[model samples]
Target: MPEAVAVDPVCVAGVDGCKAGWVAVFRWVGSNRASEVQIFPHFADLLASEHEPRKIAVDMPIGLPQRIGSNGRGPEKAVRPLLGMRQSTVFSIPARAAIYCEDYREACSAALAHSTPPKKVSKQAFHIFPKIREIDQLMTPELETRVYEVHPEVAFWRLNGQEPIAIPKKVKGSSYPAGLDARRDLLVQFGFVANFLDQKPPKGAARDDLMDAAVNAVIAERLLNGDAEPFPTDFGRDERGLRMAIWA
Candidate 1:
């Protein structure tokens, strides 16, 4: 790889899994392009190898939003409602909404009965209250903090171009209309810009593909709309520093 470029406030992605494991970094090029500039195997590696990112907009929920209870006990509860749980954001995506409900439900069930893939305890109970109580009871602040989660659906939109929601016929009620092609374009755009920031592309050039565009969206949001939270210059001491930069 060539010498790393000078992109500030790089956009990053971190995943936890066997094959599906990677952290992507991005930066903006000129006015028309954003790219997935860099790829790392893990967050630790990224932190150690690359510069400190300005604002890492993850693909997972940072907070579960303290739940509210009818009684007066501070906030109701801070639990991720079963999968398919819905949140009313200005830019809501049906597919994402449905997944929240489904994912939380599945995650909740797994927590209950000790191990996941719950036994055939009771079909009716599973449908009704089922595993929610257990899930609600289990979610703690520490666990939430330790875990890295962001709604890919939201990231997809922010990175792709912040398209409007228009559910598809098949996934009409709880699905997104944006297809693979559009998503790919967005990713590629992000990758190019990210590479530009890093000043060098990856070996295979596969990892940076989506991140480049994602990072661009992040920077675009910052410069155009001032959406992201700003980090101080001191935040850049250890790492490469945030990917924030002035392209246009």
Candidate 2:
């Protein structure tokens, strides 16, 4: 690993997990252009990279609870209804113990023990547990000030004048062109160039992944400017003091 170089105070990033690793889109604050789109095999590398942004809005869960309530966490509960049809994009995260488990059955068992009403971990949420753990292991209270948990659908809802987007980005595990186009249009309305939005995503990330990352970057800028708000007006913190709110 290389030493982290001088930070770009004006830069902010939007990141999402991808098949290869984490795909990040870096943009300068107040600029419409995305400076770069790249992938890191590990989350830690992005933190150590030369382009380390002042704020990062990533499409992943940041805070983990010791025990969960009805809707997973406060943030998920607050934002789910706001998404309407797109709410399915948000998954209810289980407890930290469940997330740390190595096997699906073990995770479900742990989740049942940790959550109220004894819910099992969903396969979709379980699939991303490793990525969640990756961020959890490296995250600290101070780091929480810079890295924020964001959901792309939630961000889009906020961007779309607080109305839920009617289109699903994917259907039956396949990309939907109309849905992608709708999101792209929203991105353009928010100052992203259509040219950059249409460019091929870097190897290992899908087009929707890139677009999700781009919207996250937009929210990062909003957060930097004090223009963004958390899902739960009053947020929660885990045992380690990591913030448990999703910003948009």
Candidate 3:
């Protein structure tokens, strides 16, 4: 007699930060199809709404550092080799003291004082400080265990058979995104419909935001199944006690 295949329902989400708010993708475990995808202005709103998932995988750095130098955090260091050409996507997080600075000068000063080698905050890293600070404050230890930090590139790399995609995310000649169709195609192989990519992103939500969030949601399912793994296995905690690790 043939063995029976088991089916069970699982609910999880992936979230990405965007201009106006955040984009999220929600789906059931072991299925390619998404239950829903939407954008929310605040993480709190997302949590309060009916779309809440049992676990949320987000494309943001959760556990922050008290200090750093030329090298980034353990999880960030761990992903670059696996990502190859796309490794530049992993921006190092600034010191915890840098998150509250009012301006670039203040941030630079804070970084130098707080970091081990007296580092300065990168313009790019500083750009996301608002989001990082927001999540840092919102995530109390009690509420944070359910939220996992994930990198979309790492998730997609795993989806693409552990090989990094050669193409850049944006168009060669223009800033508009390319390879979205191809990404959506790869996602379809996982069980989502091609039309899943057709959902018009909210104003200020870039196309990549939707794709990034969707990939996060997919990885959340992987985490539930125990298929996902954390980087650097050796994780540390911030002053507030939020763990610093990334899952893929």
Model 3 clashing residue pairs (backbone)? 14-217, 32-191
The candidate, 1 or 2, that scores higher on lDDT is 2
After superposing candidate 2, which stretches have Cα over 4 Å from the reference? Answer: 1-9, 30-34
The positional error of residue 80 in candidate 2, measured at the CA in angstroms, is 0.4
Q: Candidate 1 — what's its lDDT?
A: 0.32
- Maximum-lDDT candidate: 2
Which digits, one per residue and each the tens of the lDDT, describe model 3 over residues 1-248? 99998886667989999988778888877555546877788888877768557789998898777787667677889888999988987987778789888698899999888877777888878888888888888897887757999998898998999987766677643334456776777888877777877678778788788888888887888888888888878887778888888898
By summed lDDT, the worst window of 10 consecutive residues in model 1 runs over 71-80
Tell me the lDDT of candidate 2.
Answer: 0.91
> What lDDT does each candidate get?
0.32, 0.91, 0.81
Residue 149 shift from truth in candidate 1, angstroms:
6.0
- Return the candidate ranking by TM-score, descending: 2, 3, 1
lDDT score at residue 201, model 1, on the 0-100 scale: 34
